[model samples]
Target: MEARLKFAVALGAALVLPAAVQGADYFVTRQGNDANRGADWATSFLTVQRGVDALKPGDTLTIGPGEYPENVKLHGFGVPGKETLIRAELAGTVVLRGDRDVDLDFAQVPGRRFVYIADCKMDVLSVHEVDTLTNLAPAADPGALEFGPARYWHDAEAGKLYLSTSDFQPATCHRYTIGVLRDHGVDMLQCRRVVLDGLAAAGYRTAVGKEGLLLPTSGFMLHQTEQCTVRRCTAFFNGSGITINSGVGGRTDQPGEGKGNLVEDCRAFANRLDGIVAYNPSGETIRNCQSFLNQTYGARFYGGRAGDAVCLMSDVLAWGNPGADFWTKGGGLSEYNEAVLAERCIALRDCNFGNFQHGIIGGRNVYRGDRPHTIILPGEHEEFHQFNDAHFADPMNFDFRLQATSSFRQSGEGEAASGPHPYKADIYHVKPGGNDDLDGLSLAAAWKTPSRAVARLKPGDTLYIAPGRYAGDLALTASNICIRGRGIEPVVIEGGLRLAECRDVSVERLQFSGPARAIRGGNIELANCVLFGQSVEAEQVEGLRLNHNLLVASLRLVGCSGVILNGNLHAAAPAVQTDTRQAVRYSSYN
Candidate 1:
């Protein structure tokens, strides 16, 4: 954008569309009995399942703060417009667990597989990488360890556990015993408009099948369902904290049966695999979420096809994760069209990320402390470290917040620094018939191409694109900018939109034709838009909001949080969302 042009504007006002239906609220308390009607706090239900049976449309099931060791299955307790809500009244104090404590002796061990764990304080071991008992040798120190502390090996085939003889005896195993006993904490199958909030889930272990393949599980899952939301929740020490599965093994190319999903203000940590994951495509919106200290990627987006998936995120942080704190590839393929956008996001202290040759990255993002400390701009350059910075308050403590004398906060501000630019509502104009020769001031003299127009824009500026076919690729790096189409005629773009180091961008009322992809941007929202040819992808971005859009290929979202979808999404191909809290509303297939 032009260094001289300056304007600062916040995002559009949130529409107060409508409110959910009012319904009766039920309570579930530990001190209550199963026979109670669960109508009021005075006479609440003991078991959560009994409370589920009594739910109606738009019903609220308030679970008291306590640990509940049981696998919950939520069926069709939701109505069409209104949703069924389940939440802990006290938030973090409530835990829905999936583990059972079992006292053990060395005699019960399958092969004397006991070993020490180093939680980055020294060399550590992970159970997933163990191949043989003989290989459990000691490491030199934390730097030499491939895994982090207090990890144990599980012989899933034999149902045996290998623990440190010095640290854990049957009497001392209570700490380790605070784990999962079942496969899932809450499972949703063919449900609609369901909301889960303020719950903590943990302690899930994998089991080995006949072929020795480890069968993984999730803390909370939505399988073959539509319109679900999870928020203000913590998923830890499980195989996967949260997952949106469409079919068995998450193996399906079908368009995401679930649509318009949202996840916000959640945390996932200390999980076996990824902290958060998504399948079933059709995408989701993520915002203001955090994932860290997990075994693998902090958040991973997958289980969809290349050219079919899109995700949006902004204002998110993924730190202290060994694997690339956030990853955005689908099941087995990495295509340019598929993407995840992360804006004003951070990826700190990750082990590997530079190897991603076709990495989907966009928007004004800040990345530091990673192995490379440089991000691949895909077709733009091999390495681009535009907004990344290594200086921080403290790295050891995972404090990535900028210090008082930080420069990042300075550069983002326009240096006219004090004046109003020559635009109203902080929006500029661009048109097909307009020429680039003029000052490009008004709609009548709008710029013809995006190359010159984008350079003249400032942060919080809006590019009002007029209808007509325009060619050539467009790149946007300015934060809080909106590129919207004028409604008089169909605003068609021939090429694609590339975003890097961008933030709070909204693309609306535009139609992307041919091989055009709005790829690799963060805090992005595409509403009343149609995407064809390639997929629309967002990476490393959080606070995504996608609604009322038609996607011909896919929408890919990776390593994101606080994702939400309103309604009216049509996907011709598969869709994917990885490492995110997902919410879907009233969207349907094409």
Candidate 2:
């Protein structure tokens, strides 16, 4: 037994030693000799395509800085975990360009003749134009070329470019500079564990029948793959930044099951449609992704038949989009499977709409479907748990400042458990005094108060109020400010008070009633208070600690804990008043 244990340990060490020693072997160089063997850095392949062809499983291809005029595809059937990565060696540019000035049918430009490259792990590849020299004409300037009616005459016999309108004329032609044009640029299909990092894909023209560049026509059109990541990459001047749909060519699959894909720290700008469209991708996460100056929606998801299942997005900033910042439209059967979880997502400076829009918005149980299909805010519901407040900046043409009195302030609920997934990194850290807590007024109206009230508190500072009708929305901030009313006639903290990012604050003997919703805060404590709105179902609060308080409307607590009710609090429906014992029943306290 001792001898066998020693041998096993030795074998384990031997296997691990080779993995540590082999540090990035495969390399693609634009200046190195292509004839040399592509095994070592001294003898590397000249083009990215050559290195991709020579790569084996578990090989890391490092592309050196230079311009390479070609589209490369990697199509090797390898096992999972033995994937390939093509990364840039440094912070310089590596261009992947297409062939220019190729004689082809000009009339077929509207048709689908595309320059295509697909199925590879592309990383840090920068593409641009290649400079070429051409002949000169005398009539046109010294180094110029002309192709219009004054320089050349057309021939009716052949439907092509000829010198003359008669039989033919001697044409003085000179070569001119044209940008490297690639059509239907790069496509990845059935490729798992691929990383597209630090690469610029540009100058892709429209093909004869195809509408745009990078046309991924169905059949795992960037789908059905697992554990793939597209990070720090830029997709600009394209029809769609990345159209991830399984049903583009009329092929249907399970809805919202695009699993284990991460698009993080990437930028998509100037696209005609959505920056990133994840159609029917389940368990996919997009974090720290920014989209700016896009024509339409920044990010849109159409979770197909199976419904969008467990899609999470965090720290997503969408600015200057003409449409909604984020849109999730469910497609097929409504089994409550379209679950979209967003955290710390901001839609600032969007030209059209802001953060979110749905047929059913606010609180998961707000919708009366058989299976409870509602938006989950940052609190606890009976069936679902909302962990964060999906915040939105000021809308277009709105002059709301992001001060203590803005809606975006105090918009988030208190922090909850990060969950069991490995990708639950906090994208937006709520600032100290940014209306995160529910102890005071709404953040949107904080600045409208007297400057004296705003300056008296700081982060985490607590303030108590006497029973009086305090007009206007009182904005209470500072990290730990505890505000409480003295008298029990329900110290009416009237007006539109908004609370933001202030935590660990308690409010007592307060009666909030006015044109605005009551207090919105994180980690809030409410004791002996009456939240009397015009109607019993119009208040929007993330988390509330209501004790001996009368809630006249429906209350929602998202992803919160330690809520205890000790006094008479009734759900204000006229039908339930007949029974005195039922007037004060035990509500669920998570």
lDDT of model number 1: 0.57
Candidate 2, lDDT over the whole model: 0.45
lDDT for each of the candidates?
Answer: 0.57, 0.45
For residues 1-590, could you state the per-residue lDDT of candidate 2 as single tens digits?
99999999999999999878553567777777777777777888888767766766567778776556665554432346665676766422454543233232222112222211112122211121122111111122211112222222222234332211111122212221123343433455455677656554433333326442223221112555556666666665444565554333324444322357777777766554667666665567778787766657676555453434566666676656667666555543222333555555555432121223221122222222332211223423422111121221112212111223322233346522221111111111111233423323332222222213544666544333433455555555544655544323334556644555545666555667742233334556567667676432212233444567676655543333333344447655441221123222223321
Q: Could you estimate the TM-score for every candidate? A: 0.51, 0.46
- Top lDDT model: 1
Candidate with top TM-score is: 1
What clash count goes with each model? Answer: 71, 69
RMSD after Cα superposition, model 2: 22.5
Give the alpha carbon lDDT tens digit for every residue of 1-590 in model 1: 54333322211222322233367899998898888889998999987778877888688999986778777777645655878899887566578766543444434233323443322221122222221111122234323222433435554445545444322333133333434354667777767888889988766544323211112476777765566788888887667777665434445455445655566788887776677665644556555678877777676555563233456454556765766676655543233332444444555544222222211233222223222222322223222222222222222333333323333223443431111111133445677788888655455456788667887888867676767888876677777777777644678877776767667888787777754333344567778877775667766665666777777766666655555554545565456445544522112222
lDDT of 1 at 584: 26
